[model samples]
Target: MSVSFRLGILGAVGVLAAGLAHAGWLWFAWVAPAGALDPGSAAASSWMPLLVQGSWTFVLAAAVGWQLQRSGQPLQQSLALLRQQVQALEQGRFVVVEDPPAAEALPLARSLNAAVRRLQSAIEEAPGQGAQALRRTARRDAATGLDSRFTFIARLTERLADRGGAQTALLALRLLPVQPGLAPDPRALAAAAEMLHLFSRRVPGAFVGRLCESDLALCLPAHDLVAESAHSLIAALGSGPERLHCVVGCADHLGGVSLGGALAQLDLATAEAEAAGVGALVCRTSHREEATPQEEGALRRQIVEALRANAMELAAFPVVDAQGDLLHLECPMRLRLSPGQPLAPAQAWLPVAMRYRLTTQIELAGIEMALAASARDGLSRCVHVAAESLSAAGFVSAVRSRLQATPQAAALLWIEIAEVSLERLPPRLRNAGTVWQRCGARVGIEHAGAALLSLVRLSELELDYVKVASDFVRGVAEHAVQRERVQGLVAFVHEMGARVIAEGVDEQADLDALWALGFDGATGRLAGRQGTAEALVAPGSDAAACRDQAMSPA
Candidate 1:
């Protein structure tokens, strides 16, 4: 029943009970015990007094009944108004409806307002949720069900930023027309589809995308597929049902460089593969890349000439100690394109040296340059010695002979070997490391995470330190997984009597996180050069500002 009806019923019952009580009092006082009292007595037979008192009781009850009806009007009007507003709210109207006129209904209005506000907030956030879904949808290419090229590049950049010495490689593949024809090949679509399917299936989180009609690229995470393994997998596609003829170009994000360099390496490798012939996978592993053996020889001749003439610039990045003092300068060789072409750096040429077994020569040359620079500046300097160079015959004898011949210069030198190359440490390199230690040149490993093998035998090797790979320290500040991994590595290295240095510290925040995680030293774009520790600010000291202004968005 309605609230007004229920209230009306209650009020009517109270009035009826009052009227019955009044009638009962009149009967008891005037009519009861009439026979025992004197007939002429004023109290027993006086009708006028009883009549007056009865009349007053009836008048007072009538007055009270009228007052009750007047008071119930306001309550009835409020309840009716509230009912309409509630119905309106239920029909999806977000407007704040007027409250009941009665002040007592304020509590109900306030509760309804609170509920409406909660729903409104949910409605407000709904678009942002939709935008996030839209963004995810846009990242994928419709044809291959793979990431779009833009998305792929974005992810690669993030991976590069986070590559704490971890390996990441890109595969650029072009589907060649199997049948020699002017029109479209019947096998073209099938071949591209088959290629993408195999790649996505093999690499767990592979980001594969088509750049154009038949130009496709796949980015393989280090944890999944290194460049060599990726090369092998694509080679497997050659024997598949599609029976496709293709050229694959593989480029690895080996070290610090611009995004363009990583992509250009893919282009060079693809060009080289195309020139090699059908079903070939060629990679540009060094600074100098060429399409043919003759062209490679020409580039190699230029490199040799430059190395002999010393036509190269030394770009030294400082590695800082825990105290924010300069520990050593990591001198990377920047060789010219054609002795004076200026643009190409050693990164572009080192792969050529590696390919042709000329790393020993390059290493010897780089060391001489580093030691000269170190002696001239009176600061300790370190140079990378390629793993291939370490494996070369008589490499130890040459290095030892040079060190012995110039002990003063060697004392201020440090040598670094790629950790990936140390998976099978040569006896000669180990012996050479001991000799270098005797000569006061500290030997260490760069990119030291042993993803392929255990570091349980690291103690057996002669090493002064092992740098945590660039990937581990790339986003260490915000990545819990990386932070925990680096923490364990630092402890393990310390236990093994080797110091831990974090590489790829591209931001002040990452640097701060590495320092907090117990690393002995840090180096990257953020780590300042000699005599300047100004940029190694603590995490809370406007770290976000430093991140925003200094580094590109990852």
Candidate 2:
């Protein structure tokens, strides 16, 4: 029976017992003597039994009420404890509780504790998963699923550093027209990415990475020869349907060489590829002498100091239209001096800076120089960004902050990321582009008519202009097919709400051809040889007065 019913029954039983006892006592009194039935004695005898039974019933009710209150206390306490445990688990803390009430709360505590254990185990596994995710993130271009700049550099450096104990080589593929202006199609970029993926799969141990939007690096390990490996890679890339015409540079370590030396060799190979208009070119550098530990240490120190002091020189090339009107200047960076002497192209110092993880610093210096130059000249300027630097989340903020500090210079500042860098434009960069546009600055794409037609995707960026590769524009005059192709490209770019600038124009015919082809502007030897800021402007302009009078002649 329920507790209330049981208590009622017990109460009834107690009353019955008391009644029986009282009856017995009365019977005894009657049987005793007539004197026992006296008035005072009878009164006491009748009231005593009844009062005792009432007191017993009241005591039983009080005991039952107390027991009920005590039972509820355990339930309430258990619930409070469970809430606390769940809160702890949500906060990622897993600790065991002791001495829980065995009967009512033990099962709950065990279940909760088990859940906590599972949570702890999952939490423990998270770091490993996170680490793997970071590695994957580092290896692929964030935007296009192509290899990242860092992974590519590391693989190239490793291959170059490995002395020919086993044949090691690097294929540096530079998409022609590194500068902005050729409106690239997004489909071309995807096609290039697919082609690279296919090529990598065909060549064993060949790791492909996007060094920049305009460059791709492939490292071939265990190759029988460096030249052969480069050729094979080029052939594979050329055979692709996309027909990405790449300037391939190949380099190998003939003997023990520092990672820096290996990169230098790769740089040389890239130059060779640029010189040759083929799908690929290979240059092998045999280490002449083994670098001593002291030499390596000294080189490292030099690099550190150079990067810290921003000891680099910046040169600006004027971007002029077909009318010979100066529109903007493109700043390409060059290292002033290294441990040995001035490094030639960025390729020489860049790999080392990247290997030592100093690209961010270098990028900062480049931006600072470009901004300062823009401020002084009061002309719009375009600064190049490495693919790897673009991947860094803070890079945009750094550039924006620097630009903000120079209010007068912000409007004229234009930042151009290589086509390859676009493969991994971080969200921060994409957002930064909007911020930059709002600040009266424009964003442009460099090396437009090269591999990875997917550059068309950039149309969504609403960029100010697209610069086509000079080579594509150079001989258009001689080839009607080429001229028509460029015309169509310019038309497509215009449709995207962006203008086109042609590069590498060295002849009036070339300029005339581009003008006819509908290019917005042109730059190269024909536009004007590299000259001072003054020479870039019209004769009466302030910049023109600063031109070296002796060089210009009256």
173, model 1: CA deviation in Å?
17
Give the per-residue lDDT of model 2 (tens digit) for 214-281: 66666666534657756766677677666665677776642333333344456556867677774658
Residue ranges of candidate 2 with Cα displaced over 4 Å:
1-298, 338-344, 426-428, 506-508, 530-554
- Give the Cα lDDT of each candidate: 0.60, 0.58
Name the regions of candidate 1 deviating beyond 4 angstroms.
Answer: 1-199, 202-290, 337-340, 450-452, 529-554
lDDT of 1 by residue, 1-554 (tens): 54444554565555554444433433445643434345345443454454555455556555666677767877778777666655544333444556666678776666555544543443334322222232333356565666654456546655554424336677887777656533224466446655666766876766677644456787776522445764665666756765566778887643333243455567668878888887887765423223588877777887788777777766556678767787777766666757347734555565466557676776787788777776776778877775567777888778887777777889888887655455445544555588778877888877555231224334456578887656446656764534554565565566557888876566778877778877888776566532354443333423232211111111
TM-score of model number 2: 0.48
lDDT at 386 for candidate 1?
A: 59
- Against the correct fold, how does model 1 do in TM-score? 0.49
